[model samples]
Target: MPKLITGGVAVVLCAVIVVHLGLGAAGVGVLDVLSFVAGNGDENTRNVLWGSRIPRTLAGLVVGIALGVSGALIQGATRNPLAAPDTLGVNAGAYFAVAALAFAGVNAGVFGNGGVAFLGGLAAVALVYLLTVGGVLTPGRVLLAGATVSLIGMAGAEFLQILDEHQTRGLFFWGNGSLMQTGLDRPLVVGAVVLAGAALAPLLARSLDLLSLGDETAQAMGVQVNRVRPMALSLAVVLAAAAVTVAGPIGFVGLIAPVAVRLLGIHGHSLLIPLAGLTAATLVLAADAAAQVALPPSAGYGELPVGIVTALIGGPIFIVLARRVITGDADRGAAVVVAQARKSRFVTALVIGCGLLAVAAVVGLRVGDMDISWSDLASVVTGSGQEMANAVVSFRLPRILVAAGAGACLAIAGVAVQSVVRNPLAEPGLMGITGGASAAAMLVILVIPSAPVAVLPVAATAGGVLAMVIIVLIARQLDPTRVVLIGLGMAATTMALVNVMVVGAQMNITAALTWLAGSTYARDLSTLGWLLLPAVVAVMLIVGGRAVNMLALGDDLPRSLGLALGRTRMLVLCGGALLAAGTAAAVGTVGFVGLVAPHLARRIVGTATHRLMPMAAVLGAVLVVVADTVGRSVLAPTEIPVGIVTALLGTPYLVWLLRAK
Candidate 1:
């Protein structure tokens, strides 16, 4: 069965390669290529074949093989079918390394870039290992850690791109995982390395087979468990990094390829590695072919990244895997609850938070390209001021208001979501609302450039709510962990869709990225109006404190207490989704506000829904105001997006959250 499957995959891969080679802007056709092979070809056809088609086809094949083999190795070592370089942050790490390399103006050749990618991938996997080491390495926990690490790596790459836009011109699409190659030199070099790594991989086949039995069993059987695991994982990282170096981190190929092969009931490490590679090569080529078909090169939509296509397909597959393998219970997760604070202490924290937010707003008004002093500020308020200073404050004032309102909405959304997810670490972004909003907004922007500004926020809000609804319906129950996993998958799918539109439309990239990064740039009172509904929802949510608190209780307790658990969960979740999506519509999806602020409030005032709600709002407001201030002030003209700033703050907090007992 395994042999038939492997051979079938090889044959399919050949067909995909042929189709991929034939579909291009050069008007090359499969029949033309076949006739050329039969010795009836022109120079132009031969030039297209040798110059563009062959190199691209070879690059995809090499990358697929590398990712597939790496997936097999990691899954075998970890004994988790969901394990893959993409899930473990290796791909993100390698991608960031290459972006950094470009930013630094380094002209490292093929071999050197591969080495750098290997280091990045190795480091990322090692961090993931360290984070999950204290636990049993369950699929859910490891996957969460990997997702967190990926967020950090992506944030870093975004920061670099913002700082040096010139250096990262084509980096955005490449970062999304394109297979367009300029030449064969890089692919051939990386291919040789992949061949060497694949050969060394089988040397650990015996140890891996035993290790699959369990560490103690493997040790008892005289298979050095410690040494073998590291060797296999390191080899996996090398393979994954090589693929990134060559093809810009095409995701899910490694994951889909190995998982697909494993379903054939083949378990041998030697056979799994090579067979998975063939399957992966086929998946990559096939996805590329599908991309070409969806948006023909001759149609002028530009080449869609093969990675985007794979991500779109892989997301549902991941959701399926999570549903089957993940128990979706919080039995093993650390407590997210906190004891209530003293009334006086809670009051003090709120006061301090308010003060901080005010100070941040003031600083934002005062410290842009020029400073507006107190006198200038007062004069502006009194309708008499320095012309330039008045203009700066006038421009900054509405944005600051929008930032504060959005922040409060996000924080309350976080509080409402955490109440249900029962994990203080949970954020609205994980609910798929933000991603859905961003995706919808991008689609509108690309599909209808003449869309009214008001239409964007409305479309974004509706999209976000719709996304959350899908996640809720798919889970069919309020399983928090499962919901989170499904949300992640949904978010990936939405992001892939957004990338597709971006690649095809070739929109104004800076504006799109800033919005996607959750910027408050150019936002005014009209945008501020978008927050009114969320603010009202926030007030109502806080007022319904008892129900929100009841949600934090376990299922049986909530039911016994006569709380309509299902209805209440839906109510609070929908409200949270509204606040998050509405805020996203207004500010373009500022992240970590919903997370960091609420979590900090919990630490200060505990998890009492009423107290937590207000405290979280204050803190969240302070966070975004400060973020906006810093974004505008830091590089002066070259502003960092508030989302990136908040990510820098929130990533460390997430890492800490994962390590919590």
Candidate 2:
């Protein structure tokens, strides 16, 4: 049976290789390549095969093998079926390191680039290990920590890209895994490193097999468990980082390949590693081939990144894994208890928060590319200002209003979601709704260019609701962290959909990119209209805060209170979805405001949802306004996106929250 599986995968891999080589913009046929090898082909065919097709095909193999073997080793060492480079944040770390280097004007050669990626991946995986160790290393905990780290790393990379458009264009292919290549040097060098890692992987296989039986059993079997696990993970890092250096961070090839191999009843490390590599190569190559078939390069838009196709496929697989994996350990230390209720503190914080928000708006108005004095600002507000001051205020005022409105909506949404999920980490953005909204909005742009302007927010709302419903239905009664893990998978899938639509649009992607990054540039009062629906929803949520408070007391008590448990849960969740989706449609992502603001508010105002909701709204508005001000002032003219700034601010809080005893 093992022989049959290996042979079947090898055959599929070879077929995929052939198809990938044949399918490209140049239209190089197999016959032409064979003719070239026979010394009877034209110069065009020879150049096409040698310069582009062959190199790209080889790159796919190298990247696929690296990810597959790395994943197998990770799963083996940790004895966790869901362990993978992508799931542990290693790929995002590696990608971020490479982007950071390019932005810093470092022309590191191939080996140097690989080394940087290795260090970055090492740091990331080490952080995940530390985070998991703080609590128990459950599958859901590891994945949640990974999701947090990846969010931080990716946001940092995007921030750098926003500061440097030249580097952004240069790293585009690297940001998403692409098989396009200039020559064979990269594939050849990276392939040799991958081969070395694979060669060393078997040395630990015997130990890894024993380690799977638990540390006591492994020690009883005379295995040097500590040394063996670290060494194995180091080798895995080298392999995964090398793959990132060559073709960027490809998602899910690592996860799906090894899992598929194990499911085929081939569990021995020696045979599993090699066969999994073959299986991943087949999957990667086939995905690239499918991308070409779905959207040919000549379709005006450029070629789809092979990562997009793989992510779309991997998303469902991850959801399956998150659902079926034993997650009983997830809720062990995962209670979402807040500070003791303090009425005086809540009132004081609310007054102070509202005051600070007003101050922030005033400060933000005065801190643009050109600052207007206090007297000039007062004049602008009263419509008695100089022409220049009036124009600047006009430009900045609408953006500030939109920012405040969007922030309040996200915070209220967070209160509702956290109340329902009973998880402090349950932000609407993190729950995958924003990704759904962005994808749906992009779909409208791509599919119906002439669609009415009103259709966009409606489509976005429906998409977000559908995404949330899918997550709730699939992960019903599961651990909260497990549900969030599944939601992260859905988020990746939806983002891939957005990337596909953006690539297909072939129009000015600048506006879409800016919006997706959660910027307030060129936004006006017109954009404020999009926030009205969410604002109304926020009011409804705040009015029903007492019912939501009942939800956090676990299932039985809420039912005893005649709260119609299921209906309330769905209604509040859908209401939160409405708030978040509407905000996302109005103002891109603006991440972490939901998570951080509500969390901070709860600390100040306790868990009473009625008091918690309004305080969080005020704090959320203040946070974004401050972020917008800081972003504008940091660089003279290059404004950082508010989302990236908020992410940086919120990442540490998330880490601390998860790691707390």
Candidates in order have lDDT scores of 0.84, 0.85
Candidate 1 structure, TM-score to reference? 0.96
- Per-residue error for 95 in candidate 2, Å, reads 1.0
Candidate 2 stretches with Cα past 4 Å from truth are 34-43, 329-344
Q: Write the per-residue lDDT of candidate 2 for residues 477-534, one digit (tens) a residue.
A: 7366776778888898999888887766654454555678888878899989999999
RMSD of each: 1.9, 1.8
Candidate 1, 522-631: lDDT as tens digits = 88888878888899999999999999998877778889989999899889988998899889988886888898888788778877888999999988888999988888
Evaluate residue 275 in candidate 2 and report its C-alpha lDDT on the 0 to 100 scale: 83
Q: Which residue pairs come into collision in candidate 1?
A: none
Model 1 gets an lDDT of 0.84
Task: Report backbone clashes per prediction.
Answer: 0, 0
